[model samples]
Target: MMKEIEFTLNGTRTRTETQPGERLLDLLRERLGLTGTKEGCGIGSCGACTVILDGKAVNACLVPAQAVDGRELVTIEGIMQNESLHPIQDALIRHHAIQCGFCTPGLVMSAKALLDENPDPSRGEIQRAIAGNLCRCTGYEQVIEAIQDAAKGGKTQC
Candidate 1:
């Protein structure tokens, strides 16, 4: 059976129909047409489906579609403002942290979640925050550096 769910998606109130067993990844990418949230492993290990849920980064693949019925979700598509990229996205580009582009969205969301809670996280903290996200391209030094750079001025309404 399809059930109606209401939630705040990228600061907008939205209502949609979803089956109980549908994954949040499908709901975002297929149902809602938000494809930025990629599905790498589809088993919650790759962290490719990461999204900010209620102010924390979570694996959308593991979360039920209905789990966000009353929650706030922030996907990669939601981070931009007025045609400008979010600080995390900008930093990733400037720091050359993105390669292959498969995992960039999850990395951005993860870094955003960390910076949201701790605007000035230590290198170790940054490492821990992105530990779940696997990036074979940049060796994570650039990613960590990008997150650090974003921390300098990344704390905003994003």
Candidate 2:
């Protein structure tokens, strides 16, 4: 049976019908056409599918589509405004944190969630926030630097 679910996606109200046991990852990628959220590990061990759900970062693959009803979700695609990249994204690019670009979205979202809650987080705190996210390519040095730069108000000027 398909059930209707209403929620806020990327700051916009959205409604969709989800099949039983459908995951939010599939809903976002397949149904809603939001492919920025990637699925690396279907079991949630890898944070490639991370997204901000109601102000907290979560693995979209582990969340039931129906569970998101009346909630707010922010994917990497929604973090930008006016065709400009978010500060985290800018910092990541400036710091050369992206490699292969497969895990960038999840890292960005995790960093954003941390920054949203704590504007100025310590290096250790930033590390903790993104510990769940595994980036095999970058090794997290530049990624951590990018988050730090973003915390220091480093925004890329286009």
Best model per TM-score = 2
C-alpha RMSD values across all candidates: 3.2, 1.9
lDDT of 1 by residue, 49-99 (tens): 999999999999999999899999999999997989998898888888877
> What is the per-residue lDDT of model 2 for residues 1-158, given as tens digits with 9 covering 90 to 100?
89999999998999999997789999999999999999998998889999999999999999999999999999998989689999889999999999899999999999999999999999999999999999898899999999999999986432
Q: How much lDDT does each candidate structure score?
A: 0.92, 0.93
Query: What's the residue-level lDDT of 18 in candidate 2?
Result: 97
Off by over 4 Å in 2: 155-158
Model 1 misplacement above 4 A: 154-158
- For every model shown, the clashing-pair count is 0, 0
What C-alpha lDDT does candidate 1 achieve relative to the native structure? 0.92
TM-score of 1: 0.95
Error of 2 at 37 (Å): 0.2
RMSD of 1: 3.2
TM-score of each: 0.95, 0.96
